[model samples]
Target: MCFGPFKRVCHWGPLVALGIIKAITFSTVTCLSQWWPPQQSASGTLVFVAFSSSAVLTLYFFLQAMFTGPGVLPAGWRPEVEGDTRYLQYQKH
Candidate 1:
């Protein structure tokens, strides 16, 4: 994916996720009774800002992780020795 709104994704996972997110957002907006018939937009503006910010941030991180590799894992999670089945045992969920 490119770093832009018109970014293209080779795989379908992120695209599906993005579509789901948008659908949920629109559904939420429509389900809110106060969303329409707004006497004043100040409160609505605040709500919109809060919600849009959350969505944007979520999308940002989602795309970031998808495009960039999932970054690095912390050290010590992997056993240094080969065939180290010991570390795999007793992992606390």
Candidate 2:
């Protein structure tokens, strides 16, 4: 039913989601900036707003990787082995 190293699930899903979210955020920010007051335009406020938002998203992914090792692997269907001597022997000391 699945393919490749991670089976059917892969990093592509998250990458696509991030792309959509970033596009939406960028569009919303651009729209809002068009209506900002003249004084605000000269202050670089909109640029800072967009930059910080993107930075936060980038930082969040790094933090997530730190906390969670990686994507979940599909469970293998092999029968459960409990206290098997051969299984225990295979483990590195």
Candidate 3:
């Protein structure tokens, strides 16, 4: 279903998503500079910091999700304890 983690970056969908992210970040910085002017206003600086931090953190989390999935349970996997299979048996809907 998937390739190696680094190779995953080569896929088109994610590449496009990353490009979108970069574009949005660039546009946000551009807008902040024009209207808020981080250099001239404390509020602007704080807003920039907040937005930038959120963006960076978003990338960080995204990287984690992309590279190493949150967690997975193998298909048909079962607990080791005896009689557990009975608990797992559910009628097909």
- Which one wins on TM-score? 3
> What range of 10 consecutive residues in model 2 has the weakest lDDT sum?
83-92
Query: All predictions: root-mean-square deviation over Cα?
Result: 7.2, 10.9, 6.1
Best by lDDT: 3
**What's the true lDDT of residue 62 in model 3?**
75
The sequence of per-residue lDDT tens digits that candidate 2 reaches over residues 38-89 is 3567556756566667857775874465446555435443336654534432
* lDDT for 8 (candidate 2): 25
TM values, all candidates: 0.55, 0.38, 0.71
What ranking emerges by lDDT with the best candidate at the front? 3, 1, 2
lDDT of 1: 0.68
lDDT of each: 0.68, 0.58, 0.83
| lDDT string, candidate 1, 9-51, tens digits | 6457777988998898777666543653234666776676677
What candidate 3 gets wrong by more than 4 Å, as runs, is 1-4, 74-93
**Native-referenced Cα lDDT, model 2:** 0.58
- Candidate 1's error at 55, in angstroms? 1.0
Worst 10 residues of 3 by lDDT: 84-93
| Model 2 ranges off by over 4 Å | 1-10, 37-93
* Candidates by TM-score, descending order: 3, 1, 2
